[model samples]
Target: MLRHEFQPGRLVAGLVFAAAGTVYAGDAAGLWDTPWFVIVPLVVGGLCLAGATATVTRGIRRRSGKKRLGRSTLDG
Candidate 1:
């Protein structure tokens, strides 16, 4: 069986979008007092930004600790 890949970026973005949808749904039904437009972008964009930053940092750190191609530790 093939295993599913776990993606933190997609997960965080998806959760943010889902939450934004819920906020709109609640507002439409008069269950929420907050304005819809302001909160949705803030929530979604912030989470996406955080997710991107984390993904980039993780990649950078991983590469920084690894030996480069065409080079060996003994050559240093």
Candidate 2:
């Protein structure tokens, strides 16, 4: 049995990395120019930082018994 766990941080990171790989592959295949290889780390790092902040903030709010505006607290 597989446990259902929803982690948007990991998903965002994975998607960013996948996009970087796709860009590299496309460049290698003589596709459109993606000369901004440096963007990969910048984007990934930004996403990681944002994700971490969000996760921590959410955890803190949940622990404090506070509710966010849109996120449902329904446990189904």
- TM-score for all predictions? 0.56, 0.55
Q: Relative to the true structure, how large is the alpha-carbon lDDT of every model? A: 0.73, 0.72
Ten-residue segment with the worst summed lDDT in candidate 2? 67-76
Model 1 local distance difference test score:
0.73
For candidate 1, list the clashing residue pairs, or say none. none
Give the alpha carbon lDDT tens digit for every residue of 13-64 in model 1.
7777777778778888999676647775768686877688678867976787
**How would you encode candidate 2's per-residue C-alpha lDDT over 1-76 as one tens digit per residue?**
9998566666777777777778778988998777877666757685876599669867976776655433465642
What is residue 26's positional error in candidate 2, in angstroms? Answer: 0.7
Best-matching candidate per lDDT? 1
The CA root-mean-square deviation of candidate 2, after full C-alpha superposition on the true structure, stands at 6.6
